[model samples]
Target chain A: MKQLGLSVREDAVGNIFGRWVGSEAELGAVATGSHVDAIPFSGKYDGVVGVLGALEAISVLQRSGFQPKRSLEVIMFTSEEPTRFGISCLGSRLMAGSEELVRSLKRTVDNHNVSFVDAADSAGYKIHPDDLHNVFLNQDAYFAFIELHIEQGPILEKEGIPIGIVTAIAAPASIKVEFEGNGGHAGAVLMPARNDAGLAAAELALAVEKYVLESGSIDTVGTVGILQLHPGAINSIPSKSHLEIDVRDIDEKRRNYVIEKVHKSAIDISKIRGVELSEFKIINQDPPALSDKSVINAMEFAAKQLGLEYKLMISRAYHDSLFMAREYHQWV
Target chain B: MKQLGLSVREDAVGNIFGRWVGSEAELGAVATGSHVDAIPFSGKYDGVVGVLGALEAISVLQRSGFQPKRSLEVIMFTSEEPTRFGISCLGSRLMAGSEELVRSLKRTVDNHNVSFVDAADSAGYKIHPDDLHNVFLNQDAYFAFIELHIEQGPILEKEGIPIGIVTAIAAPASIKVEFEGNGGHAGAVLMPARNDAGLAAAELALAVEKYVLESGSIDTVGTVGILQLHPGAINSIPSKSHLEIDVRDIDEKRRNYVIEKVHKSAIDISKIRGVELSEFKIINQDPPALSDKSVINAMEFAAKQLGLEYKLMISRAYHDSLFMAREYHQWV
Candidate 1:
């Protein structure tokens, strides 16, 4: 930021901002930036493109001698991936005034039992667990926010399209379920007398697909992303099984319905297999975020002027932009 | 054994033996014993009962002033649970002259990458990896062998029988399979475009049950003992999955048929899901061991004389007895 001749500041939650003061500095700033965290075993292209692309765009505009009426602020959010805390958009959620996030932060600990506040403190970001309002953005802090990201799915490449304007981000709900059963020697336990937890997990995985497909909507997607069996020896029956399920759709009600069906299926499968439904936890269920019409129109006009064929599509993958839309009046 | 006035010694591979010399010590000895090792998180009764019971039987005969024509030997086999080296009946398999075990020991390493020879050395047992023939038993070493063990299955208790005379031990086969597919963001990957490896694993698990049930034999049992998904986050599609399946039956041909059907189902499921079957490994498939008729008759006559109700049943759970039968001329 110093090299770029812009003033810089980092917020309480490590959200970095670089501001190019304009003539009317008192007006709401035009903010544009994205996160830079990548998940494990992931590529560099995920969030890297968004953050680097935004910086490149600003550098190009400055070189072309462009002047803005409102202050142009680049905001780099933190921890967009759930790799560390098992929750996505942590920095954006704080800025968006998520009360649930605030409540969770009080007790939320990572796999290593490190509290979020302690982790931030260790990273040179002091946080007051009881008072986190400093991280929340004011209602009219931004005139608009825009983020540039590469397509995460195959749709754009399949259709030979160069650009895609996301109209809405899908609502996502995460669930974790575990089943417990009587495990025994695999060779000794007869099939008729066995209550295998691994099989219960398999049945529920298949059931998730059945319920999602039965919803009769292509937009409704469900995934049994994680399935694990306990005492996982080749000659021992699984006494316990765990599953982490992800369900999403553009329609909030439809997604919730699917989640309910999945929950019911887990219970039914457990009972039928003579196993116990030990846990059914819903981590987070966020509402869909719609793109502002004014921002969409402006992007469409720019794409048309550039003679770039672009498609207006819904983003099934949630991003920091999804949470940002809750705080800002307009976003793209 | 010292307190009981019996000479004791530990052989190569840690097979402990307590011998009570009889009048005709040169005559072939009567051997009776079992393993004392148990798997993780298991009960005290598994192999403990067998070892303690054999000791009690010897003490009772001594108290009765009984004199044996031949020597009576109690043996405690090592590493019968496969908890460390992933091979059960290790001591007995070596004594039974298993060339495969000797070959594997040259390079076989545990989860910690500790070689078998290194582990033995650490355990205060000197193993000449190149000269393991010392562990092999002579064909005429024992006149007869008998092992006292608690029933691993429920048939004896369910039928309200107090004792059971062994007829034969069931054959057991272990298989490990891995499937690989394209993984992406759970929300971003549309249902139609997903080649989910986790789902393929679930399909194969269900297929195991189906194939076993289709065999039309109540004695046939199969279990998907372990299932795991890689990159197992809630919102990431599984790119790879692994499964360890166990199948067993008293009939070798029938068990082999089920195993073949399971293999075909795995390939079929992988093809249908557009996933790659990266690994299909059969760890070990041993044939069933039949009890000697003379030993069975002697056990029946003793039970009748004692007025104890007993049933003749197959031993579904393999023990050191299974491997011992390979070398012993007669066993019960």
Candidate 2:
């Protein structure tokens, strides 16, 4: 970036900012960039595309001899996937004055024995510094935040579109449920007398899908992504079934509503099947964000100027922009 | 057995028979015994108790000088649990002119790479040597075959009975089903677009239980003993489910009726859920056995003479007596 007349700086909390240095340096800068962190087993195209896109745009502007009214800043937020700290948008959370809230969140990352704080500390991060509450760019640092990122959904590829304007960001709330029933010798237990946890669990899993479909919500989804049956033998009856469930939607109420139906079904099944059941929410993240109309319109106008076909999309995967939008109203 | 003045002999196929010299050695023996082998992770007292009970009965008869016109013999059939050879009542199967039949069954023992024959050979047993139609004592060796073994089911324990006289042995007809469907990221896949094999398999399992219960056959029972989901993950929709089903009853027609109903259910579910479904019967041991009426009556009379409470029972577990009864009409 320095070769293109851009100066790079790192914040106290380690957010990276590259400045193109417009003549009017006093005015707040226009920011366009994304994080560089990734989830496990994922391709490198996720956040890297956005960060590199900003660099290329700056290069094109320099070659074209464009003079801006305000400086253009490329900001790379840290740990946007939260795979290491166990919280998404870790840098954005701090810069948005959520340092205290994020500090209180407890998690285990990579199935490691250490807590989230220990891992973050080992990676050279601290929730709060003595001098400042918001260690990186605060809510008022940028006039507008526009990120260029590769769409992670099937829509763009299936529709043959090259560009997209994100309309809203869908966040996740996760929970786990455990069902207990009597285990027996698979053959020795008569069908009528047997209380099989595996059967009950399978029934509950189906019930989850049934009620979700029955709700008739288009954007809503519920998943029993992880299931473990106790004493999983070819010939032995399962005594316990453990599940990790994830429900996500752009609308938090809709997500919670579907989860309520799931809880009700579990209760009914437990009573009918004489199986003991228990469950609790492990994650409760609320305040889903809608894209700023002005920021979206700007992206659409840019696409129109370039004569590129584009679609209005939603980010089912939570991103740093969602946290940034909490304080900075002009988020893309 | 040596303390009781009994001589023991092992056939070429390793069946053990202990005999006390009778006044007339030419008369065929009244044989009472059972195999001492057990299934994996089972109680040691299963067939062992029966073998020891015969030995104790012989000791008592010797103490009382109870010499009969027919000689008394104690027989121990090998591989009765069938875990090692994958064929139940293996010794009896060979002795009842089923040496050819036993040779046809394929099996893997102890999760090893070798076939049942290889395992048996490694343990020192050869099949069909010249000048011998059968390696062990054939059906003609015993005049009356009586076996004393423990009931595997909970009937006696639940009914508060001290003794049980098994009247019939139920045989199992086992089948395996595999369902294949498209897998996807659970969150990204829309509700209507999913063809989840997990849900299909769960529905089919429930269908199995439903059909059996609705059939209203008290003696009938079916089990989905083995279930395996492919790429089982909390965040991924399941693509395949494999199951091993066991349906059993003394009445072959009724058992087959339930199994046929289950197959019909699988077909309906496959069509409804748009999953690839296939199934095949792995075991079809047919021609169920009923204990000899005279033998059951004699056991009942013996229970009455001892003033011990007893009940007529049906054996859900296949036993050596069932195979022996195929040839020895007087077998109990």
Q: What residue pairs clash in candidate 2, if any at all? A: A225-B233, A225-B234, A226-B234
lDDT of 2 by residue, A41-132 (tens): 44678789989999999989888989987999888987676433335576777677775544444444443577655565677766333433
Candidate 1 per-residue lDDT, tens place, A222-290, comes to 999888887887778889998888899998999999889888988888889999999998888899999
User: By TM-score, who's the top model here?
Assistant: 1
Q: Return the TM-score for candidate 1, rounded to 2 decimals.
A: 0.87
Q: Provide the overall lDDT of each model, using Cα atoms, as 2-decimal numbers.
A: 0.87, 0.73
Worst window of 10 by summed lDDT in candidate 1 chain A:
A38-47
lDDT of residue A76 for candidate 1 = 88
In candidate 2 chain B, what residue range of length 10 has the lowest lDDT sum?
B127-136
The window of 10 residues in a row where model 2 chain A has the poorest summed lDDT is: A127-136
The residue-by-residue lDDT of candidate 1 on B138-191, one tens digit each, is 888888889998887788879999999999999988888999999998999999
For model 2, the stretches where C-alpha displacement exceeds 4 angstroms are A1-154, A162-165, A185-188, A226-228, A233-237, A278-308, A317-332, B1-150, B280-282, B319-332
User: Cα lDDT for residue A203, model 1?
Assistant: 93
